[model samples]
Target: MKKLQVLYIAAFFAVCLVPFVGMAVTGQESSSENRTLAEFPQLKTEEGINVQWLNDAGEYFQDHFAFRNELVTANALINGKILGTSTASGVIQGTDGWLYYKDSLEDYLGENLLKDRSLYNISHILSLMQEYLAEKNVQFAFTVAPNKNSLYDENMPYYDSYKVSDNKNLINLQKYLKNENVSYVDLYEPLAKADEILYHKRDSHWNNKGAACASDFLLEGLGKEHESYTDETYTVKTDFTGDLDEMLYPLATTPEDEIYYDRQTTFAYVGEVGSNFDPRITTVNPVKTGSLVMYRDSFGNALLPFMADAYGNAYFSRGIPYQLTDVDTMVADTVVVERAERFLPEMAESAPVMPAPERTVSTGEDKADPEAVKDLEIITQGNYLKISGRIAEKYLDTESRIYVRTDGDKVYEAFPNDVTLDDGSTDCGGFTLYLPVGTATEKGNLEILTGNDESADIIFAKD
Candidate 1:
């Protein structure tokens, strides 16, 4: 009789606890059935205390509360793929541990998820762009940001195997672009050699040092050059933990967040919309930052400042949409397109059909030696600039003249006789000409006239 009484009391307690368990899981007020706890459902008049119900129809409730929802199923599905496998990072263990592969799955992503040889067709796409832009006389340049894994793959426990001699995934794109006659900038080689910590020991994005190196490489490749420094004051914060460390190595590694190296004098955006330059939106205020858009990826955040000083303004933005809504109105004449190698194919495909660059417009006054003048070249370094080409000195002394302008400036300059004029095989005007590295214009129009004073107007940008 006593045992029967105990069982009856236990059954009573279990029945009483069911509602409490339901409340804990669904977080709904005992009376409410249409709202979810996360939605913070409350009686309209009450500010703090409110009913939390499980809404059967709302998206949020459907997502979190739905037992068979796709998202939950996806997580479980991914987990199940490696349910019994040991994690590459030994610390994480479980039949479900294989789901952790998401973090390091980029190596296999190309073949497994992304289309195969997508980059191969990128060259063809670029060629089409070149052909299309040629009609407009616009020159197209391609840049690709290298994957951090491409540089630090050695640290990874496993890598995807692809059949190609250039083990570095980024290098393959470079060869393809070259063969297609697409001018591309290489940041990987320089950044890899730089003596700075370019990335956090655990994070996927580059550290400030690495971004700066990449920016410098980009500037140099774009014909805008800058010097290197041992240390730059990037922002330093210790309270940062990266995604990888958050997941696999939770307590193992603590990472720091850093921005640019030194304090930069910010510049106001001259053409940006109302208060778009507000510092409240970004860590740094725009009015004081340098001039130049350091077009970059997550890795580009660190590198933009390195090149910002050279321009009147510098900005950093991602390339996904590749659309700067106001860029068409902000600045015109020159646009520097930068991207990592892995992203090049996509960048090239989506690249807008830019107008053809007007190399030699019909200036009306056309004079030339019966021979075509040797190729005139303008070399622009950050500090020094030079224009060199082979032209008939005799013609230059008389009918020939060198006309140079920058950014459409009317200021004309005389050709320096100091240039060595020697053409191995003179097809015309003069032989090859060598000019000092200091004579090129910074940002503006430049022209080199061979025989007649009339010149082919060319735009020159500083490196």
Candidate 2:
């Protein structure tokens, strides 16, 4: 009995020690979490002893331990196959093996819709961008890529118990854009009416086929003549790995079907090419004529090949606070802004980096109410002076246009945008304008003005 107990104890100790022994021999495993793994914890730092060493060590071990991927795969399999749920926080397992990105769930359920002001702000931002591009004779069009679940809700797990709103951010934003006369492409209806499945079952984004459809719509909207690719032949290859699949089962192989076009590509990379997610990528087509500058996000990955093929020179960027100056530099014939439906709020979160359009607002009676405008900030960014602040919500309406007056002489219209404060909080009443630094003196008194002639003086000192 004593020998049997000793053997059991030895087996338990060996099992517990295996990870440590294997880690020493094999080193840290590569992470599949779609994020940078925590580094090894250091006990000391330049400042002093590391106060968070214990917590950091725990995170490091959790990320680098031996058999981590295998164990994670096993756990995911049990949860997904047996319990019918996802183990990864960022992924949601749906019916028929469909996987949806969790970040898009709010849009799927019609929850957390953007406020009316935000919708107007989005439209105003696009309108300003359109006006700027139009000055350079560059046609501008904007479109939102429908969320995977928004179009494929039939495959999504039943959320009928949740309170779904009739008004969605995408639908409302489209209405505002239409009212503002901003060139906007309606991608949702066309994508929804398509007979074939355009999105990957296990991926958050649409497949190449969907991207082709969007590219056609965008090109048509811009009034640019380009290849429709309607009759292009493609082969369905079953070797595509999905990001969601990799996240859920790091050690498992589950390849999805990818439609690979058989046609030869006409465009070539302008320089050393990285992955699709690079901040900037340039391509050129020797046979094509016009130039294009497109500001896009992840959805642009699939659209890149098609857009590049259609233009003589195409510059695609995923940078935020979009550098609209590219249109001038590229002498672009067309500019397209593509954003995912789920990220609509982001449009109002930051003012795009562009010269504020000069405006002439009638001088209004200066109101002595100090509470009219709050939290004003003036900072220099690039060649422009960024002035942002929040106005009392009571003084503003959907049609109230925001304008900034410098030294009570020059007037510039501001985008009805929100500013992300230092504490990470955002206010819908925020307004931002970027005036050329030389055009506006930083030490001068500024004033906030509304379309209704409401005005309040601003006191600021430049550092």
Candidate 3:
């Protein structure tokens, strides 16, 4: 009995030490996670064993813990079998091993309620883009990619633990867009109307066939000819682990058949580094009929080959701050802004521009004087104007009023929303405010009222 007890004690400590020991033997990065494994924490002279250090150490240890991947997979299995939920991550295991992302269900549930101003915001941007392109005699389209849950809501697990917002973001946005005279292609119906499976069983994005479907719709909608792809040329491989599957079970995952389109059917490009974001693609032998400048995301990856064949010169960029900054460089006949549905709010926010660390500071000494509010970027979102930047920490009182002076001394209040403390790289926090609807004019200036005695002007230009 004594020997048995001793052996049991030894086993427990061995099991406990195994992770630390194996961590030393393993590589510094995880193949499954596709990220660098945590390094041993360096001692900070100033921080010295504070909450920050301890928290960071805990994260680093957890990240580098040996056998962590195996343990996570095991936990996922146990949770799926027993709890009927994924506690390991936000991955949702659905009917017949169809995994879905938690964000999809959250968006469908309206957990992250897109504000009404967001509709006005996107429509305004699209209208501006359309008008700009029209001036250059360039056709433009804002193609909204359909959300996965929007189509396959039945596949999602039925459990409502979040506050659902009553905003029908898409319907409301579409109605507003039409009123604003912004041209766009709606892929939701066309994708749904198709008889064949358009989306992958395991991934958030659509499969090759779905891309083909969307591409076909876009070509027809834009008045371009559709290129044919025969099944004899394409190949299919089965049981591929997808993006959602990586979240749920990264190790030894199950498979689904992936269709690969023919690779031989596209044009090559001659390019210069126009943006630090993507090396701008210009075809070697330009086509006569059309040219394109496309701002796209991951779903656009599948559309690339199809688009390359159709356009003479095509420039594809995944850059944020979706602007006309690259217009003169590409000289395209068509301008396309393609966004995944969930990120519609991004249409309002301009891409952030920050100077180098040395240039970020003011030239004079004692530049950190307390001010009521420091304005950052300002742009119009139709009737509402959004002002974002930092506000003095002391003046961050919930009731502080920021307003705009429009139509010659007419005062309109700006309501702040989604303000976050310690958001930017500074002691002061950041805020976003939408000037109330119907307060806009052809040209006007905004201001912040700092108590009764003082006010600061906010200057902004759409260009």
Candidate 4:
């Protein structure tokens, strides 16, 4: 009996040592979490002994342990398949094997809607972008890809004490865009009315067929004549793996069906082509005539092939502060900005890097109080000068237009948007304008003007 007890103790110790032995023999496994694994921790650094060595070592072992992927897979299977829930925090398990991205939850429920000012800011920003492209003789259109659950909420599980709000950010933004006269494409209605399933059960984006539908709608909105895929031959391939699936079940083989068209490829990549997530991608189609510059997000992945086929020269970008200057450089005939509905708030977060529209404002009202404008700054940014500052909230309205008048009597209208301050906080009442560096010279005084005709002056110096 005592020998049996000793044998059991030995077996336990052997099991505990197996991971260490396997790690030493096979080395650390590559990460499947869509992020870099933690590096081996150092006991000392150039500064001195590493104070956080213990914590860093713990994270390293957690990421690099033997059989970690297999173990994670097994746990996910038990939780998702058995317990009917997701183990990954970024994924939300839905009914019928559907998985929704957790980041889209707030938009899905219509909670945390953007403020009226923010909606105005988004509309105004797009309006300014449209105006900029219009001046260059480039047509511009904007669209939002609806969230997965926004159109297919039937598969979503009901959360306790939460109900969908009628006033969603997307709805508000659409209203504001209409008021601002921006060309907006409504992708949600058609996608919602489609007969067949357009989105994958486990993916966050639309399928190829859905992308084709969106492409058709967007091209129509742009007033461009393009081929219609109403009867295009296609095959539903079953070897597609979704990103959400990867995040949720790293080791499990759960492939979904993806529609692939049989059309001959005509477009050619201009450079080393990575995946669709590359920051910049350019395509040229010898058979097509017009050029297009599309600022898009992940939804653009599926739309890339379709758009590339329609234009002679096409530039797709996933970068922010969108380089609208590309329209001029590429001699583009059309520009489109596509964003997901879940990311509407980002429209108000950063002002697009473009020259502010010159305007003639009548500075007839009384000067604004000195305390009304705060933290005003004029900094040189490349060939343009970035002027940004916050105004007293009480002086601003949803329709308020912020303008900057240089000492030379040149006035440029600012985009009504939020700007990130030096300390990493967003000034909600902030306005930003970009002017050509040649607009002013040496030392001068600048004036801030609002739609209400109130003005404030600031002394400035240029290096």
Candidate 4 lands at a TM-score of 0.90
Candidate 3 wrong stretches, greater than 4 Å: 29-40, 45-51, 81-83, 160-167, 228-233, 269-289, 351-463
For all candidates in order, the CA lDDT equals 0.43, 0.84, 0.62, 0.83
Which number leads on TM-score? 2
Model 2: CA > 4 A from native: 1-10, 159-163, 420-425, 452-463
Q: Where does the lowest 10-residue lDDT sum fall in candidate 4?
A: 454-463
Order by lDDT, highest first = 2, 4, 3, 1
| Candidate 2, residue 212: how far the Cα is off, in Å | 1.2
Question: Which is superior by lDDT, 2 or 3?
Answer: 2
CA shift of 252, model 4, Å: 0.5
**TM-score-best of 3 and 4:** 4
Candidate 2 on 1-463: residue-level lDDT in tens? 9999999999999998888887999999886787889999889999899999999998998888899899999999999888888899888888889888888877667787788888989998999889988888888889999998778877777653264765678888878899889999889999999998899998888899999998888888777788787788999989888888888888884889998888888999988878877889999999999999999999999989999999999999999989888888888889999999888889888788889888755655555356777888889988888888888877678767887777767778888886666897666788888888788877987777776335423322222
Tell me how many residue pairs clash in candidate 2. Answer: 0
lDDT per residue (tens digit) for residues 295-347 in model 4: 99999999999988999999999999897778888899899999998888888
In model 4, where do residues sit more than 4 Å from their true spots?
A: 1-22, 34-49, 364-377, 419-427, 441-443, 452-463
Q: Write the per-residue lDDT of candidate 3 for residues 320-351, one digit (tens) a residue.
A: 65546466667778888888876665554542
